[model samples]
Target chain A: MKLTCTVNGLRIEATAEPRLLLVDFLRHQLRLTATHVGCEIGVCGACTVIVDDEPVRSCLMLAVQADGCRIETAESLAAGGELSPMQASLHAHHGLQCGFCTPGILMTLEALARSGQLPGDEDGVRHVLGGHVCRCTGYQHIVDAVLAQAR
Target chain B: MKPPSFAYARPGTVAEAAGLLAQGDGAVLLAGGQSLMPMLNLRLAAPDTVIDINGIAGLADVRRDDGRLRIGAMARQAALMRTPAVGEALPLLALALPHIGHPQTRSRGTIGGSLCHADPAAELALVAVAADAVLTLLSSAGTRTVPARAFFLHAMETVRAADEILTEITFPASRPGARCAFRELARRHGDFAIAAVAAEWSPEGLTIAVGGLEATPRVCAHLSRELAGRPFEQAAVVRLIDEELAQTEPLEDGVIGPDYRLQLARVLLNDCLAEVLPP
Candidate 1:
């Protein structure tokens, strides 16, 4: 099956099997390896991406389902050579250690921030970012980073 | 995990989608595909064809008319949660929406998909039962509305025929004095609930629906009847929990034991009732 969708800012078309996950198509077919796949069952938030301005689990969505949708991955967050606010926050606060979960976290937070309803306080940031799990950072710095960004 | 080889059809209209479903013996509707994707990948479901309903027109609108909230089958959970009418008119649903999955899953997960998937522990199932939401199922023959009470027969079992596509879900506007709360116990923040309860309190009576603890969402009308005129105290709440557990069987799997789930049900029920009930 040939699937065409707007990825990042570019419209791309590729032939894929009906069973291919959007995450695989994005990483393997499109070579956008920044969108990592973890906990393929959708439990881990490591496969998050923005589809139609809303964050979703790319691993849990088929490539065909995204045939006409706009997809933004972690790579899209950083344009030109500068990092997105989420990436900058994660870096400044050392919110990532292994960095495997960073992309998913950034995508999820990016969606929240894009909604323009993100809180402007520490507790508010904690509540907003509480949905994503991080094995590293003890979550304090991640929380701190979100809080810093909120301010 | 890749899904089994299957033909995929992206129909532009519900009539086309319904026709596709009627043609294939084991055709399944693909909406958000949050649950279906995992099931397909695991090979738990191997339908010969998948009728992609995302392209279907007029299935993604959320509208309110004639005192009822009508949500299209394709309306995403995130979209539903953000709709002011849903938050204002169907507070229970709005409250349960955030608990379905994380924001990412909710972004694409649809209300109709959740109800049709009929997970015994799904928050939407409990909310549907508690709110007495009506499901609109469509087939080539026509359309019919099934009350939530009769829609779910067992765990992951719905009354929807293989050829029927769930079109919409409608619920009466929440009463002015109605208060609802949802409580669940999960291994982690986003894990499936071990046991959960959705409670709605009205001056007429209370409606408590327990999910994840039974084969299907169980509505304890007896408890609601008994709780009438009685204060929702610790003892009264415990009695209701005891009666609910006594009437329904908890789902037992590798994750949690039945006894543990029964106990958690009691704790969650009490907590939920305490929040909704006056002191």
Candidate 2:
């Protein structure tokens, strides 16, 4: 299937099988490797990306389904070659170690920030972080990073 | 890790979607795909044709109609959480919405998809059974409405025919002085519940529904009848729930045993009752 979508401000037109997941379309076809694939079954949250301003599991969505949608990946964060505010904050807080799940977490928080739904406090940030499983940092640093952004 | 390849069709209307489903070539309707996608990736479901219903018009609407809340089947859980009609009119559903999944999943998971997926522990299914919502099923032939209670046949099963698509679910609009509480016990905040309970009390009566107990959300029908429109002590209610639950077989999963599930349900039921039936 021929798929077309705007990704990280780039117009992408690619051909993929109907079963090709959006995460693969970005990582493999579009060469946007910042979006990592953890558990393809949607539990790991490493596949999170913003589609049409909403954070969704890209692996759970087929590339064909994302046609005509506006998508944002973690690559969009540091597109300017300088760390985005959230990314910089994550770094300052040591929010990531292995960083396999960092991209998805960043995109999830980006979606929340874009929608002006970023929680006002640490607990609220932790609540939103409940969706993403971070094994490396124990989520304390991640929560601190997101809270720093909110402040 | 990858879904099996299949022909994909994006139907512009429900009728076309139903027609594709009626073809009997192993067609499956793709709604939010939060549940189905995982199954597809895991090779649990391999359909010959995947009918994408996201393009269908008016399937994502939420509105109040004639003293009832008419929610389109495609109404995403996140959309419902933000919808004023849902929050103002369907308190039980509103209470259960946040527990469905994480924000990312809820942003794409549809209410209709949740009910149709019909997991015994799905929060939406529990809300539907608790609130006595009515569901509208559409097929190539025609449309028929079924009360939520009659919709579920068993775990991950429903009376919905293979060719039919659930189009809408109508929940009773909120009544004045209606108090509701929803509680779920899960390993994580967004994980599937091991035991969950929803309680609603209005002038009309008290309705109790529990999930993760049996093949479907179990409406404490007998207990509801016993407590409806009447005031009762907490001890009496607890004893009643205990007796009712003791007679039934609780669902047991690898996460916990049936005995523990029953125990959790008992505690949750008590907590929910305490919230709405405060002393």
Candidate 3:
């Protein structure tokens, strides 16, 4: 099957197996490894990505399903070699320990912020952040970072 | 893990999709792919063919007709919260939407998919049963509507035929002054509930469905009769759950035991009833 989509403002097409997952296609074919795959099932949001401006579990979507959609990953956050606000906030708030879950959380919050759906308060941020699992930083700093940006 | 290689077809119409499904062996309908894709990747389901129904037009519409809230099969879970029609017509569903998975998963999960997947712990199926929703099933032969109570046969099981497609579900609009509430217990926010309760109190009566404690959403007729036309009493609800759950024969569901399941069910039921009761 031929998979085609705009990733981070670039339109690209590649041949992939019908069973190829969007996460694998992004990581392997596109060489965009920032989007991590955790818990191959849909439970973990580690494979989260923005498809058509909404966050979705890339691991649970096929490359074919994304054929005409506009997708944005964590790589799209940085601008001209500068850290995006979300990245900078994560840094200032100490949001990452091992950082395996950082990219997915960034993409999830990126969509929330882009769509003007970012929560305005701590509880709201934590509720939205609850979608993505973070094994490190106890989610306090992550919540702090998101709340910082959410403000 | 990679899903087993399978043939895929995107049919442009419901008739085409139904024909494809009927002709192919182990063919499964794919809507939002939120549930089906995960099952496929886990190798828990290896259908010979996947018939993507996203291309089928008119299946995603949510309309209100003659006091019934009609939700097309492809109606996404997120839309229940975001769409004005769904938000106003189906407030119960709107209340339950955020609890489905997460905002992201809800963006791609559909009503038909969730009901067809029929997880006993899932919120949508329980809401459907609580509302006594009616489902419209279509196949190459014809169409039929089944009550939500009869549609769900067991966990991950339904009365829907292999060749039939669930096209829509309809819930009668709530009566004036009716109130509904949903409560569940899970390790995390987005995880599946260990035990859950969805309840609605109205002129019709107190309709309730308890999930994650049985193969399908369990409705206590005796309790509903006792609950109608009266203020909620926590002790009575707890006693009813105690007497009923003792004979439930809970399955060994990996994490919790039968006793714990009953306890959680009681707690959730009490919590939900308290929320929906008159102030």
Residues A1-151, candidate 1: write the lDDT tens digits: 9888999989998888887889999999899999888877776778898988888889888898888899999998889989988789889988899988888888888888888866787766655565666787888988888878878
Docking level of model 3: high
Show pairs that collide, candidate 2: none
Off by over 4 Å in 3: B243-247
Q: Which ten residues in a row have the lowest lDDT in candidate 3 chain A?
A: A127-136
lDDT of 3 by residue, B141-242 (tens): 999999999988888999999999999999988777888888888888888888888888887688877888898888766667777877777777677767
Clashes of each: 0, 0, 0
* Ten residues in sequence with the least summed lDDT for candidate 3 chain B: B243-252
Higher-DockQ candidate among 1 and 2?
2
Candidate ranking (TM-score, best to worst): 2, 3, 1
Best by DockQ: 2
RMSD of 3: 1.6
Candidate 2 regions exceeding 4 Å error are none
Tens digit of per-residue lDDT, candidate 2, span A7-103: 9888888888999999998999888898999889888899899999999999999999988999999888887699999999999999999999999
Give model 3's clash tally. 0
Cα lDDT tens digits, model 1, B1-279, are 678898888999888888888885988889888899888878899988888888888898888898899989889898888899998889998888877777778888898898999988899889888899899999988999899999999888999999999999998888889888888878766578888888888777777777898888888787777775566678767876787679777788876889998888888888888877767
